[model samples]
Target: MPSGPNSGRVSRSSGRWRWSDATRETTDTPTAATLETERMKDRYGLEVSTSSAEARDAYVEGIDRMLSAEAGVEDCLAAAIAADPGFALPHAALARQHQLYVRPDEARASAEAAVELSHSATARERQHVEIVRLLVAGQVPQALDLIRQHVIDYPRDAFALAPACGVFGAIGFSGRIGREAELLEFLEPLATHYGDDWWFATVHAFALIETGRWDRGRQLAERALEQRPSTPHGAHTLVHALFEAGDDDEAVSFLEGWLPDSDRASVLHCHIWWHYALVLMAVSRHDDAWQAFRHNCLPGTTTSPPITVFSDSSSFMWRSELAGQPRDRAIWQQVREFYEERFPQPIVFVDAHAGLTYAVLGETEQLQACLTELQELGEAGRLPAGTTGATLGQAYGAFVDEKWSTVIDVLEPLIPQVVRIGGSRAQRDLMTNTLLAAYVRSGRTDEARAFCAQVVDRRPTRPVAGFELC
Candidate 1:
């Protein structure tokens, strides 16, 4: 057995290529030898440290389903643990699932279990478990360092590499300027290791689209969807690329066709519907957009994580109002209540949207309280997104008070740092649209047209109804 960092060994046995840990000893009996040769591997061809085939198979199914945002991921992962109580990877995966659903305590518990069980596993599995443990414990810097090293050693370990990949991933939320370019740089080198893989293509496409390489992103996204049509991530990435290219017609058509077959209980379901609503708003289908929001994106209706529910619902309503829809104070109050219930603390992304809700609803007390918290977090250097959200929140408050110049003064200088708040460029358009509306309403027509031209240089369309300057 080889004893080094590259400890995964491939050997031809029984007319098949099989992967095995280099540390595993060869068995004498033919049946035992064959069983060892045929040990269960995951969909990514990484060997899982589980003796039970049922456990291994269930773990693989659960991971695939989780990556694609399908329903039944938790049940599948739970079944894997039920089949083999000591399978470390399933526990690690369950921790990730719990984190995705915003169940932090359960995530930490499962992460601890994974770490405990991984002591007897391979070095790769042990590292995987440890990274997940760090992530669930909110030790993101350590987890990211470990993930970088782990991927270099075992690039096919997709789950281990997942924490740093997407917009909400560690890098996206790193509060670093130019993080979009950083994400593309991080993923581009790994392309060879993940050729034609649906998950890789989807995330890579997203990074590309976010960085303004929409044409290349669209090609990859299309291929990813063709490779796995059921993958909601692929579909979501494709729409983002389309949205960036200003192809609202095709974007809406594709989503309307694809959404019917998707599971509403899935992770990206509400978000995907939010994307649909955005495109509908772009095309002047305001009635349809409102219907879509009411059905899928409303607080009571959405089954998304708390962050998604709050950000998506609040942003959609605010954008609708900007598009000349009458303000529905009742709906804004419902969104405000949901935000208060789900997130009392100031997560930079959620707080950014919470500001809009509070401003629109005239909740001056709540708004001031949130602003104070954000200011303190920023002053202490505790805010991962720095003061971007706080500044934007203040801008929203100014906009609500009809202080257009104040909104311009606060928001224009902060535009460069807005990416730190961690959402898709499309999602952050809530802020951009706000600034544009401020410029227009303040009779700063020249500045509005210049800003609109800059936006058009990046994207082909500006969909805000009343603030169209081009």
Candidate 2:
């Protein structure tokens, strides 16, 4: 057996290849073994220590599978645990899965198990465990603070950095006014540590584009794809940069080529389709946009959680309505049915979207029920006081009742704080559009025109088809 860059021991004979079992020893010490996969390494270049070499291989495989949004991630994690019961990192990874599934109880249990087993794990593994525990416990501020320090202490920890810089990451969802600025600044120092690395370059490009540095962002994102053409994160960043730069032709061409090969099980797959639909709409391809929406980004079309599915579906319907594209009202009813069955609670952002659906569909009963839920949540301190759910619901109810003045009164005060709902600026613009439409419907054309000019001045790239200055 021969050993080299990877932890595995390789052998060659008669044009055949095999990994030698010599890498494994029946020893009590946690040690690197031959079970490491060929050409696999963590961001830090260390082989994960485990009693069973197969467990180490399984853990590494699971992490890679997760990055590509492949299926069998849980099966891989379970294999790791079955191979080595005390492996803490795999348990922490499982907690992330539970978190995304919106099963907080399961997430908490898995995260606690990781913490309990961390006493014998490496320092890096222990830190990862802490991160999972804090996130699952709903201690977001503490989790974010720890992530910042963890990256500084272990700059090569992609596990920590990915979640910190991701589109739905802690900082991305933090609701800070200058979030893009903060992200770009934070990433600059880490460049020296992760020079030209594919994933880091992709995330940095996203931050750059979000901060309006489109030229540099485009260059970096394209470079990341050149190195790894199938990198979904790179493709996602490039799409955003292209859209923001007003290169609609290139954006459409790139996404059309990219989406077919994207893993359907991956969370980003539907989101990339959402971007594709927006590009189609930008070019007056409304029918094509609706086709994309119905076939891919719609709620029942994908396996994404109700929260994510609702966000994309509601935004797509509203955008189509803005373009004067005719849609069956039955789609609205189907969406409302799904929302009622899946999400009975007012989960801040989900509530905002559900309220939009109910108002657009004229489901007065559901709209009133949403308001009732928000009021109950607010009083119990489950949701923040003055949450967007509460305000957006009020605005929607008023819009339905033709009390447009009351809609403006409820929404205008909260527009600045709407970022608290934890979506991208593009997504939050749904609320702004709703408010502007309310102004138009109420015959406050003068105020609506002023608002349109202000918004167009602020976001020149945003489509302003419906808010025409008539």
Please name the candidate that would achieve the greatest lDDT relative to the true structure: 1
lDDT tens digits by residue: candidate 2, 220-290: 88987886676667787888788766788889999888788877776666777888888898877878888
- Per-residue error for 371 in candidate 1, Å, reads 0.2
TM-scores for candidates 1 onward, in order: 0.92, 0.82
Residue 464's lDDT within candidate 2 is: 42
Angstrom error at residue 235, model 2: 2.1
Which pairs of residues clash in candidate 2, taking residues 3 or more apart in a chain or in different chains? none
Relative to the unseen true structure, what is the C-alpha lDDT of residue 424 in candidate 1, on a scale of 0 to 100? 88
- Cα misplacement distance, residue 45 of candidate 2 (Å): 2.1
Candidate 1 residue-pair clash tally? 0
Predicted model with the maximum TM-score = 1
Candidate 1 yields a Cα-based lDDT of 0.82
